[model samples]
Target: MSSKYSLPLVLSFTIHIVLAGILLLGDFSSPPKPTPTSVQMEPIQAVIVEKSKVEAQINKIKKQKADDAKKLKDLEQSIAAAKAKRLNEAKRVKELERQRKKKAREKKAADIASKKAKAKANAADKIRKQKEREKKQADEAAAADAKAKRIKEENDAKKAAKKAEDLRKKKAAELKRKEQEARERAAQQKLLEQQMAEDMANRQQARRQQMMTEIGRFTALITQTIKRNLITDRSTMEGKSCKLTISLAPSGFVTNVVTGQGNRIVCEAAKTAVYKAGTLPVSKDPEIFREMRTISLTVAPDKFN
Candidate 1:
């Protein structure tokens, strides 16, 4: 049969052969000898003698065989049971080992996948950060360039403004100079006309002396008049002389009077007296009139005081 049952079968056969050999040896060694009889045997006694020994031996062998067979049967049963148990245990251990190996493989695969995913994520993050840094740098550079451009533009505007202002100032100065020159030329022309007219009349020297004398006489007359018309204390008017310049029109009427240095009331009275004189009794020469119309007079009330 199978290798597993071979040993039990061989052991049962060996036990049976040993028991049979013992029985055969016992029959050969104890063969039945002639039975000594005291008297003639009965027929029933002969029969009993002839079969009794062999029958008793056969009965004994039968009982031993029955006991051996029961022991062999019990032994075979126990061995079969042990083999069944060992086989079941081996199968269970193999199944457990297979499950363990499968679990280990799954765990290893999961670990590898996780590591790859983590590496990929790290790489992506690194690239993103690098791009961001580059973008930031570019922005900074652009801003710097923009700032420089703006500063340059501002400086250019300021320079243009300054240049325009300088031009305006130069133009204003040129106009002012031209106006001053024109005014000087007009004054010179008027002086030349007066000189020419005096020369034509042939009374230039005499007219000048007469005009000087008349101006002096008028000044003395104004001083006396102011002294006489004093409404204030005479001592107050005694200290200073009132000098004035009066402008007259060609018709000899006073056009304007400017006080040089004098008390306010005395200057006012002197100006009024000069106005009352209307036209001075003098030559009508244009040369003389031109000088006399713009005369300087001093009214010193103190001189008459």
Candidate 2:
């Protein structure tokens, strides 16, 4: 039992022990003595008086029993009041403990909820940052591709222009080469024409000189033919000299024969001998005709030998 209940039980037990000691020590050895009478003896009255004393004693004893019963009832009521007060105090303490536990549980649940909300917000922020980075990279790639394409186009245009200029220069060089070749050909042709004209003139000059030199051979031929036709009579002298001039046509026919210086008989004999030959000997060369058309002849037997 609790200390409060134990203290009340000890107090009740101590009071019971004191009441028992009082009962044990009180003297119950003789009844109350009869009230004393005067020293004169009366038998019947004395008996009656003794009986009255006994009845009075019995009445007092009954009254004492009633008082003891009321005291016992009062003690039992005090014990019940003490037990009720202890039971109410125990109930109040139990109710306070239960409220304290409930508050602790609510605080723990609220803390868990707050942590979960924070974690969700952090996840959303991370996703947004990743998307932004990806978009930035894609935009940079597109811009780079466009710039590369433009550079390639400009390079192609420059290459085409360079090719065209090179071709034009090549054509111009070819035209200049052809013109130079044509000029060379014209100069060569003019030189060839001048060389041909000089060669023709040299050939003609050589032929004229050759024909003039042949005149001596024609003179010899004429002298021999007239000597073969000599009809020398003994009357004509042997050592006489004769000179003659002969004329001829292109056909070598004697057109005229005349005596220049000699003895009369010898000159006359030479003229007759030339006529007897019917034609004088001359070169057939057209160039020699200029010398042979008219010729001079001398006949001295000593010199002609």
Total backbone collisions for each predicted model: 0, 0
lDDT of 2 by residue, 88-157 (tens): 7777788778878888898898799889978887888899899889988998998899899999999999
**Ten consecutive residues with minimal summed lDDT in candidate 2?**
21-30
lDDT of 1 by residue, 66-184 (tens): 77668767876877787788789889999999999999999999899999989899899999999999999999999999999999999999999999999999999999999999999
Query: Against the true structure, what is each candidate's TM-score?
Result: 0.27, 0.33
TM-score of 1: 0.27
Local distance difference test values of all predictions, in order: 0.74, 0.79
Q: Write down the lDDT that model 1 would get.
A: 0.74
Misplaced by over 4 Å in model 1 are 1-232, 275-282
